[model samples]
Target: MKNSAMIEACLACFAACEMCATECIKMISADHLRCIALCRDCAEICALCIKLEQRDSEFSHDVMQLCVESCTACAAECEKFAAHHDHCRECAEVCRKCASECQAA
Candidate 1:
């Protein structure tokens, strides 16, 4: 895949979400549980965005819209825990960047 900024942001968001989910899963709490679920969903959506963007799929634009929505929700979820977990803060930052890129794309 070409290293466009959008692609890079999406890939970074995927990695961040995966890491955030892993970290959240390690904690035993209701908030962590919610974050874990959001992170997982965000990771999957980011991965889909990457695949669709790479192939130059006709439906890529539609997928990007979904990606933006997913990223926004994930970012909000992450922000809720960002005060305590560094990983969540990092994930939120990446997700926000990815959402912006998806919108621009």
Candidate 2:
């Protein structure tokens, strides 16, 4: 349970990212394409990080690093649409938290 906090953060971020991506798709446009792609990638990376950490994989640290990067990028992209999208705002916040947790882990 050493990585409990990190896992929790990743779970939250994963949910947020998925929700954001779904919303983005509903409002699909050229401007939202990057946001959607980033959210999807971030969610996938968060899920992978959770699995790696749970099993205490040898590559957990490496994956966490990648997760941090992914979350950071996703958060930034989502933030751009925060003014017009609640889901993007929420996802950005969760992504930031997850990135912080991943860095700590």
Candidate 3:
């Protein structure tokens, strides 16, 4: 796929992850603050990577590599809560997929 399209998809996934993370943060009974933090970080990084790719920046590769690492970490964290939370499971899946694409990018 084209770089623009890939970036668009990544950005969309980032938004979804961000929203999921926010909702997860509100789980007062579960208190998944740590996982929510990681998810929020992942979302920010992913969005940044998309912008870097769009600009064709010199550090695009490095940023994308960072994005992959962040997403992987977020995915792992999300997976821990996935069994009990539908949003977490969906967030994990999206993070994994986005990580793969970021690696490819």
Q: Pick the candidate with the highest TM-score.
A: 2
Write down the RMSD of candidate 2 (Cα, Å).
0.7
Displacement of the residue 51 alpha carbon in candidate 3, Å: 0.6
Local accuracy of candidate 1 as per-residue lDDT tens digits, 1-65: 65498899999999999999998888878868878988899999989988988998888889899
Candidates by lDDT, descending order: 2, 1, 3
Instruction: Using lDDT, give the best candidate's number.
Output: 2
lDDT of 2 by residue, 1-105 (tens): 758899999999999999999999999598999999999999999999999888989999999999999999999999999999999999999999999999998
Q: Whole-model lDDT for model 1 versus the true structure?
A: 0.91
Write the number of the candidate with greater lDDT, choosing between 1 and 3: 1
Give the runs in model 1 whose Cα sits over 4 Å from its true position.
1-3
lDDT of 1 at 81: 84
Model 3 misplacement above 4 A: 1-5, 29-31
Candidate 2 matches the true fold with a TM-score of 0.97
Give the TM-score comparing model 3 with the true structure, all chains together.
0.87
Query: In model 2, which range of ten residues has the least summed lDDT?
Result: 1-10
Give Cα-based local distance difference scores for all models: 0.91, 0.95, 0.82
Better of 1 and 3 by TM-score: 1
